[model samples]
Target: LIYIYDLPADYNARLLQYKHHALACTWRGFDAGNHTYLKDSVYAVETFFHEALAVSSHRTFDPEEADFFFAPTYLTCYMWPVHGWADGPWYHAPIPNPRPMHAANFIDEVGRWVNATMPYWSRRGGRDHIFLWPHDEGACYMPSWIYNNAIFLTHWGRLDADHVSGSGWPPDNYSQPVVYPRFQPLDWRRMYKGHLCYTPGKDALIPAFKASNSYHRSPLVGVPPVKKDVLLYFRGDIGMYREWWYSRGIRQSLYRLAMEDKWREKYN
Candidate 1:
């Protein structure tokens, strides 16, 4: 399951092209350089595969891991070069589409993949770390975000099913409600204008999109890309700003959270 920030008009057709490109590259052999690239590809394939890949089963080797394991990293976006676009530092290809693959369908795919390949995630002592945070604030680590939103929740719940029975592992299928929040018409248009940096001129946009988290300390901070831009403001940079400006309520909550020292690891 792939989590996308934006869906273009021709998203389905474009994805088929990406799949074709990826498949063609499969025959290329891996090299020493690929290993170096993998180290920065965010965990060199999920850590769960450390054991699975070591066993050398031809069929079950997990191509997803292998593709990620040897995928290249560039200071610039290198994901869909054939599409004639360069994102910031992150690299991700669009999933082949039946178009608009909803969250429910994606979650089911995640459950099947995890259960079939890493069933051990549900057994013994390897529970807590079964999931990896996929969003990495847009960089070589960006997969951390996509992976988290796409597969982590499903896998984590599946792994912890014994403790949190029916804790929403495979999301309710057949009942996906289109619940994307309605954006103000003007606001939505601005978002589609492509990647822009966090600066005072765009300060008004902050309050409109701000989300609070212990991971953030400053009231105003730069957030990563939710969509791709043909041109990037910063070379390989995803700059987000946290604002203590208008949302005094959120700021106050953060202050109390800070006073209690509830999120030291994240803030520090």
Candidate 2:
């Protein structure tokens, strides 16, 4: 694995500080109890990959000798404030709108700089270059040109035609899915867009790890499971203000069902 050092000085030097601000802005009054899944997911993969690279004897810094080029871009960390808190309460009156376009622009600038300064990008049209874009919002707003011929690793791997807009960048087999720790069960209706549960060969579905307790055994490990008294249990955000049409429909239906006394009795 070969890592590219193409970002500006500020991004590299103050990375931890930027990440802290981004997380704080994204989750207002965020506490140690309420875990931030997006933040944990990004850092988990980054830490693991870096550790693997460190121990790997095959790793190379030289582009010519490297088998695959890795762009060490903290895209999720940088774009979190823009995507997660732009229209939220954190970015109210007098604050400049955190446009999603800014994320794309940042990526474009990095790509341009890498192409101009490095010879590898042009050598193979970036076919062998790999980029990690864990955040769903960032992945959604990523410019097509950057990942046209490159491999993109992301958490949001829903490859529905509805997601494809003017970007024309539908995440095909090339786009690998890095599955984060899902607290909820898989919803078939929700996974219809990409057939995420069924299509294991198309994209990689990485297993989830406990961020808080890494050394300890998983909750599901080596435990005699309890009886299933309840037929069904569902809990999550419903009818979000800016959610998609299909998502809103599903959430609304679930919310309605949960509210109905008859439905609850039947399930019980």
Model 2: per-residue Cα lDDT over 12-84, one tens digit each: 3244354535343221224479853533343345444544665677668676787777766554445443334
lDDT of 2: 0.47
lDDT score, residue 7, model 1?
A: 19
In order of appearance, the predictions have TM-scores of 0.22, 0.54
Per-candidate clashes come to: 17, 0
Query: Candidate 2 at 255: error in angstroms?
Result: 6.5
Model 1 worst lDDT run, 10 consecutive residues? 202-211
Q: How many collisions between residues are there in candidate 2?
A: 0
Q: Model 1: per-residue lDDT, tens digit, 129-216?
A: 2232221111111122223322231111111111111112122111122322431122111211222211122111111111123225
* Candidate 2 segments whose C-alpha is farther than 4 A from its true place: 3-6, 19-58, 81-98, 162-215, 218-268
> Cα lDDT of all candidates, in order?
0.25, 0.47
